[model samples]
Target chain A: MSRVPLTRKGFDAMRVSVIHTADDIVREHIVNKSVVMFDILRASSTISTALANGCQEVIPVVEVDEALAIASRLPEDTCILGGERSAVKLPGFHLGNSPLEYTPEVVAHKTVILTTTNGTKAIRRAAGEDGVVLIGSLLNYSAVAHKLFAAEQDILLACAGTRGKFSLEDTFAAGLVVAELVQLWYSRHNAAPEESCSPQADPVPIYAEEVPVLPENGLLLEDAAVAALRLAEAYRHKPLRALYDALHGQKLAQMGLSIDLNFCAQLNLYDVVPVYREGKITCL
Target chain B: MSRVPLTRKGFDAMRVSVIHTADDIVREHIVNKSVVMFDILRASSTISTALANGCQEVIPVVEVDEALAIASRLPEDTCILGGERSAVKLPGFHLGNSPLEYTPEVVAHKTVILTTTNGTKAIRRAAGEDGVVLIGSLLNYSAVAHKLFAAEQDILLACAGTRGKFSLEDTFAAGLVVAELVQLWYSRHNAAPEESCSPQADPVPIYAEEVPVLPENGLLLEDAAVAALRLAEAYRHKPLRALYDALHGQKLAQMGLSIDLNFCAQLNLYDVVPVYREGKITCL
Candidate 1:
C-alpha cells in the first residue's frame, strides 16, 4: 500500500482500529501506530483514578510474583503493591482490583506496583511497540481523546478483554473512545472554513453536493472500530445504566464489588491522561 | 455454578451467552448448549441462503484439502466443491465466498462441500457438541430465532471472528441474534397475566409496580450476550447501512464482491432455518 501524505485538510482519512482482546495483539503490525488500552472493569479505571489522585507512577507487571519482586526492590514506604486475580485481591497484597480503593489517601505520592489478570498482559504486549501507549477508560475519556487527537497518527483502541475472551465493559469503553475520536474529526472537518482560518480547512464542503461523496481512497474504519462506535452510540443515553447492567457488572455485584462498578462507570471523572511508557504508567 | 431450573414463568433466568471467537470456545463447556454460528460477511449467510434455495445439504470442512478429498469421493455430478482463501475462489473450486453465487440456479439440488478462512473452523470447534448447531445470518434471522426460542435451552451465539480475532461483522451479527431473543423473551413475559388464564400465566404482574421486578434467580445473560443485544438495538434502524459501511464489507466491496454484500444485507429474505446436524447443514 502506498503511503498517503497526511494533509491537514483530510482528517476523514485518518484510520481508527480496535483490537478486542489482549490475545489478539499483533506485535509487528501494531507497533506502527499509537495505542490506547482499555480494561474498563477496573484496571484502566483504577490506573486513571490513581494518577488523578497524585500517584507518582504505576509499574505494570504480568504476574503477581513479578509485582512482588519489583516491590521488594523499591523502598517499602515509597511503593505500594496492588493487583487482583479472579477479581479478588491476592493474599498479602495492599490493594485489589477496585478503583474506589485507589483513592488519593491510598495512592498519593506512591509508586503502585500493579498486576492483574488481563490489563497488565495487554500493556506487556504493547511494551515493545515504538509508538505511544496510553491507558484509557470512562473516567479519563476526554483526556485520552485529546492526547490521541494531538498525536496525529492512526489510533488503535485495544480492549483488555477478561481472561483472553471478549469483555463487554472493555469493548464498550473502546467503542466510547473511538466514537469520541470520530466525532472530534467530524466536528473539525465540518466547521465553516472561514471561521477559524485554520490550516486544516477544506473550502469545499464534502457533504454539500447533491450526492455526498467520500474522499477518494479515504482512510476507512476497520470493522471492529465501526462496531465499537455503534456500540458507544447505542449506550450514549445512560452509559452508567448500561455499565450497571453489563454481564461483568452483575458478576462483580454478585461478588460484592458494586463499588467498583459504580467507580468504573463514572464518565470523565478524571482529567488525567495516563501515559504508559518505559514500562510504567504516569499522568501526562 | 449451580444449574438453574428451566421454568416457563421466568424467562429472565435463561442463559444467553456469546462466544466472540473460535479460540474462546471451551469444548467441554460449550458442548452442553445449543450453538448458533454466525459469519455474517458471508459464510453463514451463504450457507443459510444455499439451504433456502433448496441445496441438498451443506457440508462444512475446515481444511481446503479435506473439502477436495470429500468432493473426489462423491459422484461427479451430485457434489460441488466450494470455498475461498483470501476472498477469491480456489483454482478448481466451483464457487467463492460470495452469497450471490449460491443462488437457486447454481446450488439447488446439489450438496456443497464448503471450506473458508474462518467459518468452517468455528463450526468444527462446535461439531463435537451433543446439541443442535445451526447456521445463521440476517437473511434468515427470524427462522433461527424461532428455532432457538422453541429449543428452550441455553443459547450460545458463536461469532466466527476473522482468523481468531473479533470481526466487527460477526460480532454485530451475534449481537443482532441476541437482541432479537431478548425482545422475544420480553414480549412473551410481559403480556397481561389475567388475560391468558394459561399455565404460563403469572398471578402478579411483574412490571405492575412502580419499580419493575425481574424474576427471582431467573435466566441471566452473560456480558457478551448483553453487549450483542445492545449492539443489535443500536443498528436496528439502519442495519443495511451498517453492513455496507462495515470494515469487512468495505474490503469485500474493494475486492469486487458488492453483490455478496447486497445479498447478505437483506433481512428475512429466507424462511428456511438451516440446521447443522451430524456434519451436514440442511434446511428445515
Candidate 2:
C-alpha cells in the first residue's frame, strides 16, 4: 500500500476521535492514524517522566507474571520491575505505579518493566497497529500535541479508563491535548498568508497546495472533539484540584498514595513524548 | 436480599458514577442503585418524548426479527413497529427511530415496539438488575433527577455510547443530570435547619436518623462525576450547537435527518420520566 503524506490541503479531512476505554477500541480506528494513549492518573505520567529522566526504555506488560517472566531474562542489573495492582506496589517488584518513583536516580539508564491495572492493557491493545502509538498525560501535554501536529495524521485520543469504565482524569488529559492541537492548527492557518503568500505579490501557484482545505466558513470540529476541548478549558484553571477530586485520584489518595496525586497533577513537567511501538515505550 | 430505603442519613452512601459506555457497566454497579440511561442523540430522547405525548408503552427489543415476531403476535392496529439501523429507518417498519414521527396523533394509546442501534442494547443490559432502570435525556433531565433524589438511592448514569465508544452528547447529558442532583442535594441539606429541628425547637430526634452522613468535608464528588458536570456546564449555554455539532448528530444531519437534530436539541421539552421495568418503557 502506498502512503500519501497529509499536507495542509488535507487539514479539512483531518479528524479527531476519542476512545473512552480500551474495550471501546476498534482495529479500524487505529489502522492509519496517530493514536495517543492517556492513563493520566499514573501510568502515562510515570512513563513520560521516566523517559524524560533518562530511562533507556519502558516495557509495559499486562500481567504481573508476564512482567516478572520478562524481567528474569533481562540482565538483572539493567532492568527494574515496576507496576501496581489496586493502587499498591505488587509484591517483590522494585517499584509501584507512581510518577514520583520514576526519578532520575532510580530509572536513569535502566530498562523499566512496568505494568498497571489499566494503562498497560491499553498500550498492548494499540501495539502492532499500522500507525504510531504515543503515550500522553498532563505531564507531557504540549510536547505530545506538538508531535501530533507535526505528523499531520488523523488523531485518536485513546483513554485508558479505570477498569474498562470511563475515567475523568484520562478524558480530561485527552481534551487538553486536542485543545492544544486545534490552537496550533488555527495559528498556522492564520499566519500562512503573512509569511510568504500575498494576493498582490504572488502570481504563481507558489505554496498553493500548502494552503489549508478548511471549509469556507472555518475549521470543522467534531462534536466529541469540541466537547473534549470545552471540558479541558472548563477544568484548566486548577490542574491539581481536577486530579485530586477525580474518582481514581481520590481512590489512590484513600490508599495512602497522596504523593502520586501531587506528581501527576504537575502540568507539562516533562519535555519527553513517550512513543510506544513494537511492545515497548521509548522517548520520542 | 432486603432493600434499604435511602434516607437522608444514607446520602453519603448515595454515590453517583458515570458509566460512559454500555460496555463499561458491571453487574456489581447496578446491583442496588437506580440506573438512569442516557442516549441523548436520539433513542432516550425519542422514547421520553413518546411517553410524554401519550404513547401507551414502548417495548425495546435487541433484534429486528424479535420486534417483528412480537409485532406479529400483538394486535396489528394497536402495536406499531419502530426502529432504525445505521441511522436509517428499517424497511417495512411502521416508523423509524425519530422523535417527530412519534407525535400524539400517531402514537397516542398505542404500544410502540422500538429498537435502535445502541439504546435498546443498553436497556437490555440493565433489564434484570435488582434496581430501578429509568430512561433519561435532555428532554426529561429534571424529571429523572427529581425521581432519583426522591428515591435517595445511589445513582449510576449509564451512557449508551455509539457502538460502545464514548459518545459526547450522551456523556454531556449525563453530566447535566449529575450537576442537577448535586445542586438538589446541597440545597436540601442547607434547608434542613428551618424545616423541623431548630436551635431551640423541640428535639425529639424526629429527623435525627434522617440527617446526612457525608464525610467531614460534606459531599464526596467522584472525579468522573465532576468531569461530567463540567462537561454539561461547558455546553449548557449552546444546547443546540452542542447537539448539532456532536459526531452522531452530524452523521444524522448528513443523512438528511436534520429534523431529528432539531427535535432532540429541545432541552426539557417534555416533563415525563420514562421508567424502564420488566422489558418495557412507560411514563412514570
Candidate 3:
C-alpha cells in the first residue's frame, strides 16, 4: 500500500489549469499516466450512490444519443437513462443527474446508462490510465482514499468540470480527497503505532515527496487559497456537499426529483470501490 | 460609489464563454465589451503595478518586435522593453514575467513598451467598453474596486489566460474582482439590487444572465454570483494587496522598472480612469 499526501492548499495550487474539455485535459497531458474523476456535482456523486445502493453497473456516455442507445438494450423499467445537457435534464430521460435521484427504490437492481456533457468526457479521457480509476466525491471521499492508499501508482483527480471549465466545488472535492490521502499516508507510517508490533516492519517516515499526493490545499495557502478554505470550512457541517449539485441536480430537485439530502451527504456510505476499466465503469 | 456585495463563489455560477484570441474577441463582437484580462501568472499583475506606480503610460503592444520598436522611439533611458514569450523573460528584453522583476529604481519616470503572449492580447480584446478599463490583480485589488465603483458604466474583469485556454490564476483573479463587485452591491442595495441597479450601474448583478463578461472566469466559478461571494469571503483578511511587487516593479526596483506596493495598492490613485473607446483604450 502506498500513501499520498494532498493538502487542501496544495490541491488549490495545482488547480491552476481550468480544464474546459476532455480534449483540453488530454492536450495538457493532465492524465500524467494516472487519472480519477472528481465530479462533486450530481453525476459522479449520484453514480457513486447508485452503485453503492445496488445498481449493477454504470455506463458512461458522452452524448444523450449514446445514453439512449445504451438504454435501448436494457429493459426500460430495469434501466434508467440519467444525465444532463446545459444543466437541465434531458428530455424523456427516466432520471436526471442527482444523487438524490438514485434512491434505493429508484436505482435498486437497475442498470444506469448515464451521459453528461462534462463528467462522462472526463471519465473517458482518464480511461487509459495505468492505475486504478476510482470515483471521488465528498460522499465517498474517505473510501477513495483507502483505495488509493492500498494502490501502487500515482493519482490524478480529474475534475469533471461543468462544461469543460474549473468548478470550485469539484476542486474542493479533490482537495478533500488529497487531504485524506495525506492523513492516511501519515497514519500508516508516521504516527506511533498502537501495538508497536514487529522490529522487522520498520515504521517509515511519511515524506510528502514519497507518496506524490496532489497538493489539494496548495491554492488555499496561496492568495486565493485562504478564501476557498473558508468557503469549504464554513460548510463543514451541512450537506453543503449539496452545494456541488450539478445544474441538472437543482432542476431535477425543483421538479421533486429527490428530497433526501442523505444520499447527497452521506459520508463513507459504501466500502466497495468503483474502478474505470476497458471503457466501462464498474465496481470490483 | 455603489457598494456591491461580490464574492468568489457567486462569480462561479455564470457561464464563461472564453474567446481564445484577440482576433476572436474582436470578431465575436467582444472587443471593448465589458471584459477582464486575467494574467494570473505575472504580466497583468506587473502591468497593474507599473501603472499604479507613476509610470507615464504603458504601451501595450502585441509583437515583441513592435514593443522594442516603440521603446526605441521613447527617450533614451526613459523607456524599458519588458515582457515574456513563454512564461520566461524574452531574450534581450529587460525583464521576465515574475513580479519580483519590476521595481521603482528601474521603472520610475520611464515608459514600458510591453508585450506578452496572453495579457497583451487580452488587453486588445477589451479595447472598446462603455465602462472603466481597470487592471486587476492580487497586487491592486482595492485600487481596481475603487475605480470600478466610481465608473459610470458597467465593469468587466478580463483574464489574460495562458495561450487560449483557461488558466487557474487568471480566473481566480477574475473571481476576486467579481466577488468585490458583488460584495459592494450586496452591501449597498441588499438582495434586490438587481431590481434597481442598471446593467451599467452594476453589471456584476447580471452575472447570472448569459451575457459573457468577455475574458471568462470559466474555470474559477461555476455560478458567477455565488462563486464571487465565496472568493471574497475566503480572503476576508490578511491583506495581500500590499504584496504588489510585480514583474516590472522588481526589475525597476533594481534599475529599469519603477513601481512599489504602495503605488499599486493606492486605492483609486488614477483619478483619470481608462476605458475602451473606438477600438483602443483611452481615458474616460
Q: Score the docking of each candidate (DockQ).
A: 0.22, 0.18, 0.10
How do these models rank on DockQ, best leading? 1, 2, 3
- Candidate 3 residue-wise lDDT, B1-284, digit = tens: 02221212334223323332333344333322234555545566677656555565667787988887777777778887788775567988887755556677777677777788777767766554332245566665655655554442234455554455433345445555555565455564454434311111222121132221222322222343344444444333422221221222222233322233223323333343333333333333
Q: How would the candidate models be sorted by TM-score, starting from the highest? A: 1, 2, 3
Q: What share of the true interface contacts does candidate 1 keep?
A: 0.30
Over the full model, what C-alpha lDDT does candidate 2 score relative to the true structure?
Answer: 0.74
Which is superior by TM-score, 2 or 3?
2
Q: Write the per-residue lDDT of candidate 1 for residues B1-34, one digit (tens) a residue.
A: 1222121332335677787777777765464466
Model 3 lDDT per residue over A23-105, tens place: 44552343432355777666678778888888878888887778877788877788888888755678999877767777788
Q: Write down the lDDT that model 1 would get.
A: 0.71
Q: Report lDDT (Cα) of residue B4, candidate 1.
A: 20
Instruction: Give the per-residue lDDT digits (tens) of candidate 1, residues A1-284.
Output: 11111212324466777877777777654654667889898889989988999999999899888998999999999998999988989999999878888888989999999998888888877555443478889988777887777666677788887777667778788877776666566566674322211122122222122221233323346667766766676666556555555656656665766556666777898889888777789887
After best superposition, candidate 1 residue A193: deviation in angstroms? 16
lDDT of 3 at B271: 40
